[model samples]
Target: MAVSRETEPPAGAAELFGETWTQAQRYADLLSTWGVDRGMIGPREVPRLWDRHLLNCVVVTPRLPQGVTVADVGTGAGLPGLVWAIARPDIQMTLVEPLLRRVSFLEEVVADLGLENVVISRSRAEDQAGQFDVVTARAVAALDKLTTWCWPLVAPGGVLLAMKGRSAPEEVEAARPMLRRLGVSDVRIETYGDLAVPTTVVELTR
Candidate 1:
């Protein structure tokens, strides 16, 4: 439905809906309507997106630098990208999804949210200009291939964050050579939350 009744506060463990429960309900309705209209989510997937998808994305989002520009590669349905935009309104975002249909869905979501600083690019992540401070992808492809696909879109001194299920240490090691080849040298992992399958955030830096 609406946005989550949740947000990680500056100094607290976490807060239930930064604003209010009613506001959360409103956001839930907004997102559900948008998801339904754009076909970004199916009727059954709504609950999952609200919990495991959207909330999961925002839960780990505080890990990033505030107000930084970010791009979401292979943003199929704009989970973390759109969720990030909603959580941190000041952070500029580009959702780079090569599929025109998905880009169209992103466009609708941006318009519905009235997000002024967001854009949808119909191009592969690697082909885009290296302009964003952070590049992110959520369960898009295998970590090894995804590393090569998204690393080039990151600005130097910036980072690429891969949101994954289960541990990606082996994937990170497997992707090390690809990372080095793509100029993403330092690879590290940060795991967080009590997910049934833990969420691992793979950070790639130059």
Candidate 2:
């Protein structure tokens, strides 16, 4: 089918996605094609889409409480948001994006996948109303600024899972004062999966 820079799914894709493996493939195709064309994903990302993007996001799905509502703030191209929705049908997913172009792309992807559990919110994180069981963001911003924006949307007793890279611990330390002010003492860095570059997530419970 001549997918643009098509890459094979990683060894554990099927294991991670289970019965939704096909849907995940379709989503990958979209990300490789439409997602790149629309500037949602870079062309350089296509070849490693599975490992760096898809798998990186799905591995964190186990952290989500079953059937809980999750909001992915600034979900550009639906990284962890749409990816999580595709992998976990049991939970409700909201992909919150401010840009209309991205929102349009997300809407098309949701409709194309017939994903009934996903919702597209055309608003920025700060403007988004209501709280959710989990509020998440990936490559959105640094811990301090990100927490400032996402903490409000996390319902009391809920959590904010910030997908970070190697700087997670440093970011946590830098944001300590802000985190303490938010009444968030239960913060930890959790790594998921057995991959060489496992996904690192900063989990903060409010």
Q: How many pairs of residues collide in each model?
A: 9, 0
lDDT of 1 by residue, 17-88 (tens): 353333334445655666566676665665454556756776776777878999989887876787777667
Cα lDDT for residue 195, candidate 1: 55
Write out the backbone clash pairs for model 2: none
Model 2 spans > 4 angstroms off: 1-4
Clashing pairs in 1: 1-28, 1-29, 2-27, 2-28, 2-29, 3-27, 3-28, 5-17, 6-17
Which one wins on TM-score? 2
Candidate 1 matches the true fold with a TM-score of 0.81
What is the per-residue lDDT of model 2 for residues 43-101, given as tens digits with 9 covering 90 to 100? Answer: 88998999898999999998898999999999999989998998899999888999999
Mark the regions of model 1 whose C-alpha exceeds 4 Å error after superposition: 1-39, 194-198
Write down the TM-score of every candidate: 0.81, 0.97
